[model samples]
Target: MLSFAHINNSIFAKSPPFRTAAKRLFHAALSQRMKIIPISVLEDNYSYILVDDKTKEAAVIDPVEPSKILNVLSQTGAKLTSVFTTHHHWDHSGGNVELVAKKPGLAVYGADARIPEINYVCKDHEEFKLGTLTVTPLHTPCHTKGHVCYFVLDPATNERAVFTGDTLFIAGCGRFFEGDARDMYRNLFHVLMRLPEDTWVFCGHEYTRANIKFALSVDPHNEALLAKAAWCQDKTITVPSTIGQELLYNPFLRVNEQALKLAVSKSDPVEVLNTLREMKNSFR
Candidate 1:
């Protein structure tokens, strides 16, 4: 299991105040906009802090613990505007109450009406703004029925980052808790795969090492899968894989791959997904 103790220290070290001042002066001198600061949270879950260097306004995504998040905000001196919850799971949404208590009237957004302390209930494709940052909510309900992923488009860089909360991961997809293989297939292949190839994928959880092990079992002939597993072992760090990379190496994503199709003994994509998921569950 991964430890989260280091997360709080890392966020404080990269606080917004330091970045904001530095970015503002740099932007003014160079006539370029500042890049956003992303803070990883929990064991593998990432709770991003999108700060507007021009305005010092900020928003947080899927805060698992409020104390650590609030500490980062306090150190950074960034005004907390809103909280985005990807799902109702305790690991993702447990900090909602305390966070709202700290920042009264703060809007907490989630697709599930069941999310605790949700101030703004969002739907698929609903758009919201925090400072200059615009986020679109995509309702992806495979891990859980109301699970949502937030896609952010930075106006300055035109870069995209998808905050996939539990629905997707580095090399594997989430368990079929509230949904099934078909639900995951559409979410992973249809929705997420449609994004730009370079889009950075920030998923929930740090299961890459274990996920890749399962991936190799399903598709032993994949050279890329073997290499990635070795790389992950060497780093002693969780691999933050991209959507494009997952497409190439993840058996769950590559349901159409011949090796996976043969392993599952099914030509259908959905059946392949089911087989891959069951295989992952059985993996040590």
Candidate 2:
């Protein structure tokens, strides 16, 4: 019902500039173009709508509810093309059936073979395109064996944004439900940490305030952690921290920090990660 070109143009105009301009200039300059929309759902989950204003085609990520997302598409006048699932968790994938029912023949992409009505099963490092937007799927298996995040490159602004489902949160990581501390360590430090410092992290939940509180207990001497915790308390707002910010305040992500290393009783990155995760699990 919506004009695709109008929606595509709108997103292109709104996309932010690349966080690492210098590093991405060459690669991003030659990539496809697209725009993204983030729709918050289910108290903390964020469902994203990636639309190419020029083509009016759109994709949604981790939709927990359909009505809200459908309304957004209608209001913005964008045609829904696909749905991307990070994992098969109920909270993250519950809306799939309703959405598919509404948009018959719509393709739903996910790494999990167990997800309902999955038409396009994705793999790690797999690439897909919608209009001018190019999305790369990173198979991060800590939260769930098939959990995957989508890295979007918008050529119009030459920027990058990642939709990190449950694998990564604003200032915390997901619980090791299907994987162990080591898997999460690799996912956070080796995989995600390798990205640009300024990459806007559009995570799954709004648990920033509570996560930072626990982080403060782990590293009481961390000025940034304390300050962020206090600010979160004062404003009663969830901090949409970036990966760079997490490196500074998130205990799980800061396994190598001298103070965190000391608290965890280990200098080894993996051990530090394990200790921190254990502490957080018991933390009230």
Candidate 3:
């Protein structure tokens, strides 16, 4: 006497207790995955704590103070494995000495000697494993001669993100202090842009609002930029801008777009980048 609908419902439905226990287990499993926590230090700087929850191993990127990082480690119950430095700027490397002093034999990685307490000088294109996560260091030296970006990927899944330390921002790129516009073009377009469009961008600053303002000035007609401006107004959503969204709205990445080219009055991408950078340097 069982109808088809009743049979289907019987097969699919679960008892309340069973569903509750399943939900709890699902949440517990999700919580055990690798996580990236952004710790804002100084005025606009962001130091990240990349933690692999299953193994409870952690790496602090560009720490400004040891106490903040120690606090995170204590909260997560994760042991400090190493520190990743994107560039040698003082704000980015300030806590390196103290962190190493706290965790003796901790491997601090960077591209140059300027990063304090750098025990492991990472080379470009090198891959390092941190628990279930795999990190590839991309040497993007235009920010500084030895600047590098750490690209983190979950080998078992399509989950990937890049830690762009001062080299690239949310809607803008870094100031070309040590290199020319050409270096930036190569690093931003040729190097970083080649990654999957969904790669999460975790830059080193809370400059998204200013950067978006600059972007809207040059690329006003872009719907993505317009929507993003509306969303970003009076709010701080700094980390985790995707490559796809940036390619759509970021003027630095959209140098070849006709609207941005006209705004900058330049045709060549590098020239457009130079013009945009100069404009941003003086942009309110």
Best by the lDDT measure: 3
Judged by lDDT relative to the true structure, which candidate is superior, 1 or 3? 3
Clashes of each: 0, 8, 0
In model 1, residue pairs whose N, Cα or C atoms come closer than 3 Å (at least 3 residues apart or on different chains), thus clashing, are none
TM-score of each: 0.85, 0.84, 0.88
Tell me the whole-model lDDT of each prediction, alpha carbons only.
0.73, 0.73, 0.79
Cα deviation at 210, candidate 1, in Å, is: 0.5
By TM-score rank, best first, the candidates go 3, 1, 2
Positional deviation of residue 139's Cα in model 2 after best superposition, in angstroms = 0.3
Residue pair clashes in candidate 2: 4-56, 7-53, 8-52, 8-53, 8-54, 9-53, 9-54, 33-132
Give the per-residue lDDT of model 1 (tens digit) for 100-192. 887898889998877889988887897888777678998899798999998877786676668888888878889999999999999988889
* Distance from true location, Cα of 229 in model 2, Å: 2.8
Alpha-carbon runs more than 4 Å astray in model 1? 1-44, 234-239
Candidate 1, residue 236: how far the Cα is off, in Å:
5.3
Residue 203 lDDT in candidate 3: 90
**Candidate 1 global CA lDDT score:** 0.73
Whole-model lDDT for model 3 versus the true structure?
0.79
Q: By summed lDDT, which 10 consecutive residues of candidate 3 come out lowest?
A: 1-10
Write candidate 2's Cα lDDT for 1-284 as tens digits.
11111121232222222211122211223223454556667776777777776687889888778888887777645789899898999889999999899889888999998777799988777788877777888889978998998887666665667889888886688988899888998898778888887666778877878788788787888888887776666332242346787788878888877888888779898888877777878889
